[model samples]
Target: MSRKKYILIFFVIILLCLSLVSYSNTTIGRVLRFGPANANDYLEFPYHEISTTSTYFKFGEANLENIVKSRFYDVTYGNNQKVGDLDQFLEDTDTTSFIVIYKDNIIYEKYYNNYNRESIVTSFSISKSFTSALIGIAIDEGYIKSVYDPITDYLPELKKRDPRFSNIKIIDLLHMSSGVSYKEPPDDIYTYFAPDLRKLALEKTQVVEDPGNSFLYNNYNPLFLGMIIERSTGKTVSEYLEEKIWKPIGMEFDGSWSIDANDFEKMESGINCRAIDFAKFGRLYLRKGNWNGKQIISTGWSVASTAPYGPENNEYYPNIPIFKEYPGYYSLMWWGIRRDDKNYDFYAAGNHGQYIYVSPEKNLIIVRNGISYGKGMESEDMSWWPIIFYQFANQFPSE
Candidate 1:
């Protein structure tokens, strides 16, 4: 063989070996193969299945479905522009599934991109909200004494690493104000793909600010909460979720939560289930954590999670561009926007545009799942969704 041919063969062999090394099970391997995170990433990672109750609760169809299909309001430039067809706009935005519930009825539900009612989509950071709810349930069940309890009380090993850990309260984690040093590129990516998440959490968490002093939206907060839940409840977060919330409220389908190599649930993210089931979670919060007549989580917790705050609490909200124009707020992992009536509309948002939005006064709930955040009027930080939701909900006649 010629010298050039031999060199080419050698390089090709080396490339093949590297590809085989990262072909599966590792974060880099998945990213190289599947590209960035998407709505269907549940298939990429090992997960723990959360079984459903024998009896399931399903939303009833409204007399008139797709009631708000005419126009989509655009508030990009602070003006309402009646856009084109609503369905087409959703398609243009890469929406995989969109649902609307009013008066506990499925008023409008549509699936796109080969997705349907039975399709499974990943929750991304929306799982953080679920983690927050679990904390409230843990407290109610007496497994956890109180939110004021230092997290080290549950994960005492953290105190051994740093005595300052004793100062971080459970509420600090719930509020994303635990002062854990976190950055999106390295920290977020590392936690998402770390082979041993529990170790990374316990060893790598370094306090940058005093607890409850500022909001960083650190993913590590939920991760630590997952550890706390496991220690306090003597069950995995997935198990607690299945028993405390899922089965009790009658989730229609069995869900799953992603886990690391050691089998710890990735509490920062990784909930996977159907869009309708996602709406059920929204309904739970909308009705003040009550399912039918059963109180799943205390009404006080439900109210406090979504309630609005004054500008004084602005630091607690995500430091995003949209907050400059809209009084956007974050409380206990839930995002909110102050309405003109001084009421607040809250929602759970995740990466790549997963949302479970609820308006308490309107008795409305909306769920959105997407492959990617399709073309919108503004960036992800300055989303047009709040306006779209407000306009759509207002179209209905007064109760």
Candidate 2:
């Protein structure tokens, strides 16, 4: 071979090596390019080290008139309805922070492990609830005609890409019944990356079941739903959020959403925000989407989103150990833990125990952010969370 040809081949190999190194240094690459090395690490991270990420949109400041601080009582919670101190329970679960709101007042708040009001934690799948709210707002604005419309109506590109996309209602995505060919194991790499989400959106997978026929907590459902919202509104979710909900509702901090190396929003599990701001979002829904007397989201939409998709008996989840006793009642990317007729708890939950829990009957809102690390912690019966939160709410007598 000529000397010139040998040098050309050498340069090509050098360029490939350089590209691989550069990709590893990218934002998403730094955090996730190498991927999770263990199940616990994949599901949760220590509180102080939770802020690493890729691209994001910064929210502007909306000062809160009140940042009331309150002391927590000796709240009882955990397996077998065990009674214990709230602080101890929090420590065992590796809680980063916990906030309790009652009757529009901050009743109990605490930050642990160097986490404070200003410290932001990753929302994980709790962001799905935010995506769901955006959908409700879009529906009210007539950006999209109806939630029941087939998703292909908004994103024509998805038509005929795969048979699975056909006849899939927007509501099915909201209700996790699109049968979108997904499984959410704790160590699933798709849960933590943006590229994987986009790739899944376009993959041609076989249609395993009819849409609206069952429940499956697939990330693609919310990811595609967010895409539909962007298409209909001509805005990223963050831009629309600031205009419609964040500023009007009075969020005090500039929360952010994780974006991929390619700069697309993760859309499902990538939201990051101060713990207090998380409560405010819950408060908006608690007041039936009315903030400061403005109906930012329709009351009907809020009610329906929080309410169960159908009869409590019909809901079913994948046969996973963590969800051994899954609620039969799933709602629009939210869970209505139908403990009973009157005291059902509506909540937005994330992996490793992040939650925004709202119980309308008690006029209560609870936010628990955590690393939530331990052996088999992912499979723990988290339904106990609302039961204990209700117990905390009942500490104060009603009028």
| Candidate number achieving the greatest lDDT relative to the actual structure | 1
State, as a TM-score between 0 and 1, how close model 1 is to the true structure: 0.92
Worst 10 residues of 2 by lDDT: 44-53
Q: What is the lDDT of residue 231 in candidate 1?
A: 92
lDDT of each: 0.83, 0.68
* Ten-residue stretch with the least lDDT total in model 1: 71-80
> On residues 359-393, what C-alpha lDDT tens digit does candidate 2 reach at each position?
78777788998876422234333445555555555
Q: Please give the distance, in angstroms, between residue 41's alpha carbon in candidate 1 and its true position after superposition.
A: 1.1
> Count of backbone clashes for each model?
0, 1
* Model 2 TM-score (2 dp): 0.78
